[model samples]
Target: MAMDADLVTAGVLVIGDEILSGRTKDKNVGFIADYLTQLGIDLKEVRIVADDTDAIVEAVNAMRACWTYLFTTGGIGPTHDDITADSVATAFGVRIDHDPRAVDILTRHYQAGELNEARMRMARVPFGADLIENKVSSAPGFRLENVHVMAGVPSVMQAMMDAIAPTLRTNSALLSETIDTGVGEGLVAEPLRIAQERHPEVVMGSYPYLRDGLFATKLVLRSREQDKLKAACEDIETMLADLKGQRQAQI
Candidate 1:
């Protein structure tokens, strides 16, 4: 955690009907979250919409308006069903056309006359967007305002992130500490709540786990303020120890 870091936040839009129907498992959301977090940008929301135009447009506009940045994956490829480019254009109220730079990149990647009309569809971009290089496939993604459009494929999306990472804005990355207690959440809830009350600025949560028929509670504390986060973690540690000791005494 850094003292002067601003809370830059982002949202992710996963567009595809295949994903909703369970035909295509999503592989981009987690990567986007981890990537953004590494850049100190908090991922506040993630929306998965169908390939339908209205759905994509509405979700994109809504998330883009609210977050510092919005990332979209899927539906940007070259096919009849790939309506993401058009939907994004409609959302921004801008024209969509074959971007020459994108076309040139594709041209070089494909042999003469091999780059057909369908493949050229990858070159289409919304007006006013800057191309995001795709080192893996040459068909670049684009960045329009706060919205970044990337491919659905995991490797390609990862490459696009690398290409665009330098341009993204960031803030203080969250810091987290976890303490495990060999007891159930019910045994620690009250004391944990009291500790959280003492540190309002930190986020505190308890997760219960069952292993080998034994229950345990994992307390995770997160905060951008390192000092406060450290103090809260310390308090939780003491609370857990005292609680465990008391339980042992009663046995």
Candidate 2:
């Protein structure tokens, strides 16, 4: 789907073989959604790619080019397979090396002589990139242009998000209202379609659910313009009420 040009849109590139293999349960996507919703940034797309360098580079390049911002998670660690920083560097055509700022932070955290080669790998970052401080762990993430490289661990990723949030361009919050319609999709299908076509700016949807053994349909209306959303909601309620009265009279 096409993104709304009026909104600040973001894409998530999840890079890790473990996540695709179902070995690791990813917790970052939900965290990011809630975080972005609060900041008024629309998350338009999400992709999961393996730890392969080529795949990571291609996904990063596409997402960074298309979206206002791209947040990447996983593969930034001390292991041989941790290649996100270097792959992102390849995508941006920049030199990758051990950044001293990151080194100093990790150095201070590790005990004397405890910062081995594996641990030191965390210091590697792309040229011209700025460090994203990790309050959960001393190791840092990096920001290169529109892409923000973060940790795979949920806590560390959250810390990185908090660090870079204030720097991002945000939009006004998307407003939403949910009203229960004591009917099913069959009863409101035509009206819902008409409402959606009439108000293209609003996101109108019906969700079916069971409450205390009784089924009902919930009308969820969303829009950045509060007045427009309210009007669409009122129209839907009136349509449903008219249908109810007609049914009672026919019975």
> TM-scores of the models, in the given order?
0.94, 0.95
lDDT score for residue 53 of model 2: 93
- lDDT by residue (tens digit), candidate 2, 10-66: 999999999999999999999999999999998989999999999999999999988
Over the stretch 161-240, how does candidate 1's per-residue lDDT look in tens digits? 99989997787778989888778989989988898789988988899999789898898888889999989988888887
Query: What lDDT score goes with residue 191 in model 2?
Result: 86
Worst 10-residue lDDT window for candidate 1 reads 1-10
Q: What local lDDT score does residue 136 receive in model 2, on the 0 to 100 scale?
A: 98
Q: What is the clash tally of candidate 2?
A: 0
lDDT per prediction?
0.90, 0.92
Q: Report how far off residue 224 is in candidate 1 (Å).
A: 2.1
